[model samples]
Target chain A: MGEDFAFWLAYLTNGKHLAFYASFRFTILAAVFGALLALVFGLLGAMARNSRFAPLRWLGTIYIMMVRGIPDVLFFLFFPLAFEQSVEWALSLSVCSAEARAGSAWPPCPAANLFFSTTEYLILACVSLGIIFGAFTANVIHGAMRAVPRGQLEAGRAYGMSEFQVLTRIHVRQMWIYALPGLSNVWLLLIKATSLLSLLQINDIVWWAGQLGSPNFLPQAGLVHGDWRWAYYTVLFVFYIFVTLGSEQVFRRLTAWARRGMPLEA
Target chain B: MGLLEAIWTDIQLLAFPALFNIYFAASSLPIGFGLAVLLALGKNSRNPVVSRLSSAYIYAFRGSPLFIQFFMFYSIMLALNPIWWRPMGIAWFAMSPLFIGPLALVMNTTAYTAEIFYGALRTVPKGELEAARAFGMSRLQVFRTVTWPNMIRVAWPAYTNEVTFLFHATALVYFTLPVIGNQKDIMNKATELFERDFNVFLHFSVAGLYFLVITMAIFFVFGLVYARMMRHMPKERQPHRPRLRFGPKYIR
Candidate 1:
């Protein structure tokens, strides 16, 4: 027990491992934010796809159709960079205006100092995740919206409800029951994908795990432990399994509650 | 014209690696599919041993993430034969981006495809198996003629989607391997282009477009194959057939 405590202390206090532990926050943050953003984007996309307007429907359909076809990794790299550059450009524009007006080397005032720092960079990363997963969420939500029977909407209309009322009261409420299962799948996938945020230098768990496992610092003098990334990764695997199981249980319970009166399969 | 030539050369250079990746993915499908189908069969098997082993394989593969599996394989190889690199002139299969890419994908894809095949196999009507047995058909013959063909017919659509997903997932290869000098993949090249040229927007977009084009091509070809297969099917078992809608319909 003492040996185990020492081993864990040595493991946790390592600076790189500390970064890795911190990275879990990013992972959890990204997962929650991405799910929420994707939910919003997905809802809007689904609404647009099912809209009366032709172009909006086409736009929504195309987004759903195209994104699933393209790889998530591609979007991971592309969207983040695109968002970063856009933010930088906006900053550059502000800076240039300040320099021109004040005749100083320093840039002028902006919305917040945070935007100039890593805070905005991380925000951009979050936005990228949202964009990447939004298409998946849209697919889930669109299917869910469709699952809300057309007759339900007509029934609402028969009760003298407006289109907006029918959508808000009947369609939206019922869509959750159908969407929950797929949305849960999307959430699970998003969690796995949070690991990829390390590639963007967000210092996520995978990155830190690699850092702590490197033999560069530790000289415990046993087997040298050169490339034991596997062990750390194994821990991550177990972590993910636990997370997925917990979330799945929660989602399953939610689904059961949502389907109180419906058929078992439904 | 020079720019056009460079682009052409780039495409030409990418052709072999792309083919290699595609070959690796395509070949693994059969092996993985075979393993998965066997497991699926085992899952439904009357024998306890077969059932238990397959159920275990399915759970282990499905429950874990793929990236960790790749790393685990690499570590295990190195630990087993540290000097294997000296003789073979290859350090580790995991470090070899080529091997890691395919290994991870095959393992992951196999797990997925197995479930798909298993589902389809289970849905095969019991009456058909009974009829085959009644006709003095051996177990192998029953499987070959009655079960296998119907499984393929039922599982083809889901199988097509899996193939597309596998092709897309191949991008993960870039992160796993030690990409030597210029032998990088489209994703690798895109990453390098971003760092070197700072043309993140242009380069990534180019890579994304490349992936989009390849995915479309695969989809079209598969569509053709699907159409051909459908044409060969009995008229009654065409797209409008109710059995075409196999698996859960949670997603409308």
Candidate 2:
């Protein structure tokens, strides 16, 4: 048992395993940035959805509808490629010389090309994830807003509070109680969605796990294993469960805090 | 090429693979639903061991990412044949990607669907069960006549969401498992074209449009069923309100 433990320690701490560490780091960072961006998008979407103007409501509705109507994996695959091409196209049009533009290829210029580094891809993944998840958040917040009692807003107005004041002081404050459950659900979903970063060629946990666990016959990598991918995937599965359970506990506490001083139903 | 001509070509290329996507979802949904019912029943069993086992199965499957589950299953199947089957006389252990892909999807969807059904089972009113008991119905009779139908009815809306997500998840199969000759799905075809012609977004857009149409069809069909099953409830109790939210509802 002692020897086995030592062997695993050496295997895991090998220089090659640095990718594993980087994968976990990037996964966490992506989730954090994605959640923050989603919050911003969600707030804006919710406000637009609730706006008095028809055009703003339409704009928000269209965004939510289009994002939600398709599979998220499709968006993850399409958005980065599409965004890169658009950037390259715009750059080629403006920056490339007339002679460079005479090429028959689509971009028509090599020098004006815009290649996305890993960081840019990560940012694009976060943005796409944010846009997809933000629609759900907007719906949750919108539903929670509607669930808030009309009398509370009336009470605020009775105190000579302005419309914006009533919205900020009463509606926004109380909506958290109702929205906590859905937002927590979205948080879990977003965490899982971060795994799609691997599809985008980002070196996330899934990518690293696939790389490390693939069958290797060469002697250079130390402790060559024959397709231990199942073992690696099992480790990933446990890690995700840990995250899920931990988040559940945290959300439970937040729900309790939100429920304080409120009625039982609320 | 012009944008219109390119998009048309992309759509033609994707048409074949889109059928496989449909096949994945179609074959899995019924099997997953049946397993979900069994799991829901097991979860509410009187025996502590059975109930705990069922809950653990649901929790483990639902908590993890489906992508990892696919990888695990693929690797396990690949390893199992050479390690366990070759020693034995069984020659059928060489599992194809075609077999393992749907197996993973069905298992994953079963977990989520079981949770939805379990939630609906818990909400089965106590008064109805007691009334059925007073009428001299056996436990089996109570379940078949009173409990099961009501559970399905209560769970239909959320189950619709599960079906939608499951259908969407079919797109992930080609990504996780190997795509043998002519076995590619819509997303696989789209990515192939995207890689072939790096600058064109038309291929991906065509694939996305196909998925959008499929999603709408799912919503329409499920909405009709929901309306029919839920017609017994009062109008106010029915979910007439539009569900604008677009995330996977399985986590709830």
- Of the candidates shown, which would achieve the greatest DockQ relative to the real structure? 2
Tens digits of per-residue lDDT for model 2 on A1-266? 99999988998998779768867877888899999888788888999999999999999988877777678888877777888888887888888888777876666777767767789989999988888888888888888899999999999999999999999999999888888998998899999888788887788888888888888667686657888888888899899989999999999999998898877864
Give lDDT tens digits, candidate 1, residues A49-143. 77899999889767765576667777776776666566655666765565453542222334312233445545666676687677777777878
Q: Write down the C-alpha DockQ for each prediction.
A: 0.36, 0.60
Candidate models: Cα lDDT each: 0.70, 0.84
Scored by TM against the true chain B, the candidates give 0.81, 0.91
* Tens digits of lDDT, candidate 2, B1-252: 687887787778888899999999998999999999999999999999999999999988898888888888887877787777677746253477667877998889888999999999999999999999999999899999999989988788788778778878888898998877888999888887777657446777788789888878888888888788778889887876224345456732
Q: What's each prediction's TM-score?
A: 0.85, 0.93
Q: Which 10 successive residues of model 2 chain A have the least lDDT summed?
A: A103-112
Interface RMSD of candidate 2?
2.2
How is the predicted docking of candidate 2 categorized under the CAPRI scheme? medium
Cα deviation in Å at residue A246, candidate 1? Answer: 2.0
Candidate 1 lDDT for residue A51: 84
Off by over 4 Å in 1: A1-19, A94-118, A216-225, A263-266, B1-17, B81-95, B234-237, B240-252
Q: What fraction of the true interface contacts does model 1 reproduce?
A: 0.45
For model 1 the local lDDT of residue B142 reads 99
